[model samples]
Target: MGQVHVVGPNRALLISGSGASGKQPRVIVGGRAFVPWIFQRADFLSLELRTIIIESKKSATAYGVMVSVTGVCQVKISGFRESNSGSGSPKLEKDVHAILLAGQHFIGAKKEEIEHSVASTMEGHQRSILGTLTVEELYKDRSAFSARVRELANEDLRLMGMELVSYTIATISDEEGYLDALGISQTESVKKVAQIGESVNRNEGRQRNAEEELKAQLKINEAKKKIEQSNRDVEVMQAKLKEEVNVANARADAAKLFEEAKLKQSIVEEETKQDVVRATVQVDVESEKVRRRRMELDASVRAQAEAELFKKLKEAEGIREFASAEAHRIKLIGEAEAEALRKKELVEVDMLRLKADAYKEYGQAALATRMIETMPEVARAIAAPLAKTEKIVFLGASGGSSSGPSALLSEVTKGAHIVNEGLQAITGVSLGEILKGDSSLNGLERLAMPIALNAVVANQGH
Candidate 1:
């Protein structure tokens, strides 16, 4: 018997040397295959995923910023098996070819050696990708960077009969604190944005609150206005009701007054009818009485008129006789009185003629005599107002020449001088000239004496 070999789900069996499908190797997966003891040899390849740690140091980025990178990668040999459908399709052929290549490259290799080789290849590709990208791209989006790195290394890995299952960046770092500064910048930016968002939200909240308050106030004002309007409507309704009540009352009163007036007019009409009947009867009775009284009055008036006519005729006769006698007596008295009056008039004419002749002959003496006769009366008349004065007041200085009786005498003298001036103005002759008996006193002096004397007598009488 030959040695028996078993293949697991995660492993592939490779048979090489003579009797192994010519120069090409036979691959077995998920089953056992027999190998002749002397002519053929068998090897196993791990088909399971292998973890590769890739670390790149001092790798330069596109911007010349040096960075360090650490990553993990899952890799495996390409697996294949005979198709159950027994079809040689292009995709199936391609899978078979890949498995053949994987067996040739990794057959009999240790897990460590495979990992090391894959890590070296991944690291080189990581560095190349790093060179093409910015440090921010490498740090911020490691997945995309890792994907790019895996895509670049996968081509080479496929040539080596391997496939990259997955690539992940475990850590990204820098020697110059570039990543730390980047993290800090991002953290601060996030904090600033958060603060700004909070402030905006707070302001919006306040604005909404203010709007709500304003709306509430507007509602309250509208409500109050409505209430006031309602009150006004109520007041108007009440006033209208009161006016209607007053109007109704006034109409009722007018109706009552109208009825009362109608009743009173009926009563007055009935009373007037009764009064007319009574007045008609009384007028007939009074007419009959008046006719009788008129007949009696006519007879009595005729008798009285006859008596009065006879008495008047008698008195007329007596009056005629007395009048004749009285006329004769009056004639005798008139003749005698006429004779006495004619004689008296003749005597008076003769006396007036003689008096006029005497006055013409002695005009100066007559004027002088008149003045002498009227001077005392004039003096007394001039002093009459002073006699009636209850008391005399002297306002002048006591010891002066104008004080006492001297002032009184001076006032009297001034009054006399005023009188003399008046006389001169009236008669064109001064009192002094008249008293000196100046020969210039013509007929004017005679006229002046009488007027002066009459004025003085009138004053004395007052």
Candidate 2:
């Protein structure tokens, strides 16, 4: 019976002696494998990660400046193994070789031994990298320096059946104070730049504030100017409106006055028409009265003449009868008296006929002539009141003592003129033309004169 060797996840199992395959050992990772106790021996190589701290003191850089460096490296063994038939890809083949090497060298080795071997190799590579870089390069770009070290040590470690998982420079320092002096210089330069930038920013802020203020002030001034112009426009508009209102009022007043004047003129014209109508009516009434009076006079005259004629004829007949009984001389005397009476009767009848004819031909003109003849008496009657006054007191402005009488005479004359105009309007005759003997008289006045004289004579005889 063979013993079962159980392999852990982090370990590889190695079998040596007679049970191993050919010249190489049999490697197993994980699971169980059988080994004869007498002929074969099994060993485990840990596949867990290992950490190494490498330190170098007083290493000279490319500039001959001595520096000290402390670094950390992590390593692990590859778990790849070769198959039994040895048929695989080149990359797999390489990995198998690396795994076999790791098993050969580290099999049954202690953890400290593995760590020492790896640490020694990593330390040597770190020192070599340090010699090529300046102290500033090592400090400023530690990751780049670490990566260079890892790259350089990977091949060597793999050949030893180990792989470098990571490498980093933990600390780097120089024996001299050059790095300290450089830090001080850089800090001063940064402070100076910050102060200059702060001053420039503050100046720019002040300049922008001034420009904005100027723009705001200009806009305010423009607005104020516009406001003033608007106010002036309002004032001008108000003045124009006031003027228009005044013009309208004036026109209305003028129209009112014109309408009033037209109304007054129309009233006067109506009054004049009324007066003319009244005058015409009065003239007709007077003419009718005159005609009736003339007729009555004619009738009275005719009655008286007929009565006298009858009386005379009877007297003549009696005288003839008495004379026939007496002498012939007495009959001759009676005939003479009777003949004289008849001649007188004939003359009166002829006169009456002539008077009637005159009245008919010049009725209106005769009336006018009669009125004119009585005008002086009418004037005397009108002035009769003034003559009765014992004391004459003139009121108002007068030129002299004569002014009163003259003014009275002027008024009387104006009244006479008005009456004459009335007569002309009513009777179709102008008394003024008759008195002045103007040729404008229509020949009625000339005919009326003889009739007027005969009327006077006939009246006296009666």
Candidate 3:
């Protein structure tokens, strides 16, 4: 390994050695390399190079004013040259100093030495171009000034195997302040124009605003006048409506009163008719009551007369029955009297016969038996008053004392007195006298007694 010379990708190799190349415009080499000789090793090199080109304070005159110009240039290798004989000087084509070895032939050179030569050459051209141009032309037309400088520098840069990529005038200054004075004059002129325009706009705006305010005021007055007229019209309409409503209300009230009066009159007439009808009905009711009472009285009188007739008929019926009964009783009494008289005659005949027969047979006993046969009739006559007696009271003792009267015995005595009273009434004979006088009677008197008894009974019968 003799000086390996491994070239980078951005570099080219200038192989000037005894192995394969002499000075054939720097045999461009990149990537890996091989060489058989050590003392003839080739140097590695780049294909492109960039360098800054700047110039300081170069003086130029314009309109008798002294101005200083400062400028910058960007430079790079653009081409290459090959000195095949490996003789003469290094001639530049694309000014690729990285491989060409600037200012020298058949020898290696540094990139800084080639770049310094480029800068010096560009500065000399820039200063020569500015010396003929004025400051006004350079400031106002920098593009034209820069073009002229590039045109002048391009030939020398090409000869050096370099090209100016870009150039700019960074600043231009003058000790007299010429640009500042020109800027001040132009800026004041623009300011005066803006001030004049602003003043005109202000006046126009004020005039338009005043016209708008006057037009608005006129519309306000017109609207106010119309509103006042409308209010007056509304007041007139309201007054008319109020008058109509009052008249209608008054007429309605009068009509209501008239209807009320008619209703009252109708009600009064109806009440009067009802009162008269009530009085008539009352009188009819009273008359109907009187008629009913009269009918009741006549019915009561007829019932009383009919009752009297029936009563009289019943009394007359009873009297007729009593009269018939009395007549029958009288007829029976006359027949019984006749029958008793006949029987008395028959008894007298029989007594005569019996007397004759008794003198021949029974003697006085037959006379006694004949007298006992009349004793029942005699007792019936005596007890006739007792048939009317409802109750009998014995006022005396149940039994009398031995020497005084006996109630039982008194009853027999009363029967005897009663029998004697009947015999005196019937035969005109006091049987008590016959019993009290105990004188014995001769046959003639005794016979006369029966005849006298018969005659008295018959005469009483008549």
lDDT of each: 0.67, 0.66, 0.55
Task: State, as a TM-score between 0 and 1, how close model 3 is to the true structure.
Answer: 0.36
Q: Write the per-residue lDDT of candidate 3 for residues 4-96, one digit (tens) a residue.
A: 567664566555556554455344444566554664656544445575655646366545566777777777654444454457765534333
Please give the range of 10 consecutive residues that has the lowest summed lDDT in model 1. 446-455
Please give, for residues 1-462, the per-residue lDDT of candidate 2 as tens digits: 679999976787878889588978787777789999889988888888888899898888879888888998888897753445545443332255666788878876789998999988998999899889987788778999998998899899989988888888887776687767767777787888888888888888888898889889989988998899999899999999999999999999999997886675455445444543454455455445433443443344336653553443344334323323432433454465345436555433444454466567778666764573454345445445555555654354555443432344345555566666776898787765654433443223322322222322222334
Q: What is the Cα root-mean-square deviation between model 1 and the actual structure?
A: 32.5
**What clash count goes with each model?**
0, 0, 5
Candidate 3: regions farther than 4 A off: 20-23, 36-41, 44-53, 62-64, 79-112, 189-462
What lDDT tens digits, residue by residue, belong to model 1 across residues 1-462? 456788887777888888777788888777888888888888887788888889999899999998888989998887843454546453432255667777777766778888898999999999999999998877778889977887799899988888888989988888999989999999999999999999999999999999999999999999999999999999999999999999999999999998986776556545444543454355345434433433433334336653553343344334334434544554565465455436556433443454476557766544544443354455557667665655656566755567643354455556656766776677565655544423443333323333332333333345
| TM-score, predicted candidate 2 vs. hidden true structure | 0.44
Residue 306 of model 1 has an lDDT of 38
